[model samples]
Target: MNASPIFHRLALLAPLLCLGFVSISCTGYQLQTGRPQALTHVKKISVPLFENKTLVPRGEILATNSVVDAITNDGTYHIATLHEADAVLEGTMETITYSQVRSTRLDTLRSEEMENTVTLHWQLLDASTRKILSTGKATGSSRFAIDANQQTARQNALPDALQRAATQVVGRLTDDF
Candidate 1:
């Protein structure tokens, strides 16, 4: 069988197209697979029970557990004991505040919707020296409807706020941003 002109052109172009694709595939692209430089020394972290300065009961437990879960999910640092850790992350549930988001149409003085916020003061310290490596404050909030039981509504939304704050703390620790 005799090859047509179109077939000859296609045969020549295939190798050139492959070469072009191969050449551009690695244009300044690199696999980045490590922690940030600031946290290079801290591979394992220990989280103690946080202190609760607010009136909310069990707020400290929720905050501490949230941070631990975030760190575990992040996979950047191992959750180790105090003796095995390179750094200790200690935090305090400073304030649990609430504000009215939406007022009732009939009664402007009452709240139809409200927001619950949790503020955390945290520090990353060296396990051995106790020297402060990083310290900051993070706040997380969630909006909830004012049901018949305001206390119950507020309590139900506390974990979401705590989780958001914890994620922020872990992100700052791992990414340094």
Candidate 2:
């Protein structure tokens, strides 16, 4: 019996597929995101309180602490004081705005969305040389609406906005992508 064209192709592919499986069974390498090579030399980092150019009270402190938390969560970089760091990450908060996103249709107008947004400029530098290795601007926002617990919603959203902004800054600093 003569083999059909489709059968012939399958016969050729079958051996290759078997060979691939055999190779994998014998030895293999798993894909992974290894340590960030760029940050390898950076043993410690100093993130001082960011410069707050806006009127948000304690905005600088919030931004600074959020960045510290992000880096600490990364577990690759050590957080150090400015005097004892390999790199210093300096950030400037350019502006922050809270705006009403929407208003209710009810007789007494109520805010449906309160958006908190922050824009920041950041730089990573060699602590000793003061050479800037990286710098850029990033913005992040978070929103809260009038809910059953208005007080809790307001309290959570503002800090969430700041935290989101700070996380983006950290990602920008370390991410190779």
Candidate 3:
């Protein structure tokens, strides 16, 4: 009896097909996309009012509220009080600066849009271990149109800056893949 050419080819491909099927079928794992699992052991976190070194008033309060909101929205970690949390996030605003983004057509003599940039530092500490998990300093910026006054511009930028800084701090807290 002679084996056909098609039989020989099919025999070689059969092992490869079986291996593929076996590998695919043997593993029963599905990746969850909603919640990030960068920090394995930590589940709950506390965000107290941040400290601000800048002259900008209420900077600390804004930063604290935004960070807490971001962490809460992440859904990966639960927001808890210091006593109830596994870890605590601490933050400090080092400096805040503002500069002209551009001048407008109507306001030829003055800049109508301004940019506020904040330099900040933060730490993630494990309450149980009494050890720091992460620490870093970064800068965040926001551009806002002036509302005919410097105070209003500063006020508008404060929230924007805080929201961005919160994002930056959360990025520092987690280990990226």
Best by TM-score: 1
Candidate 3 per-residue lDDT, tens place, 35-82, comes to 335356778898888998988888888888888887876667789999
- For 103-172, candidate 1 gives per-residue lDDT tens digits of 9889988999999889999999999999999998988999999989999999999999999999889888
- Pairs in steric clash, model 2: none
Model-by-model lDDT, in order?
Answer: 0.91, 0.80, 0.80
TM-score, structure 3 vs. true: 0.75
* Residue pairs of candidate 1 with colliding backbone atoms: none
User: Candidate 2's residue-wise lDDT over 37-66, tens digit each?
Assistant: 655577789998899898767778887888
Stretches off by above 4 angstroms in model 2 are 1-38, 106-110, 147-155
- Model 3 stretches astray by more than 4 angstroms: 1-38, 104-109, 175-177
TM-score of each model, in listed order = 0.86, 0.72, 0.75
- Candidate 1, residue 93: how far the Cα is off, in Å: 0.6
On TM-score, the stronger of 1 and 2 is 1
What are the candidates' C-alpha RMSDs? 2.5, 6.5, 5.7
lDDT of 3 at 118: 84
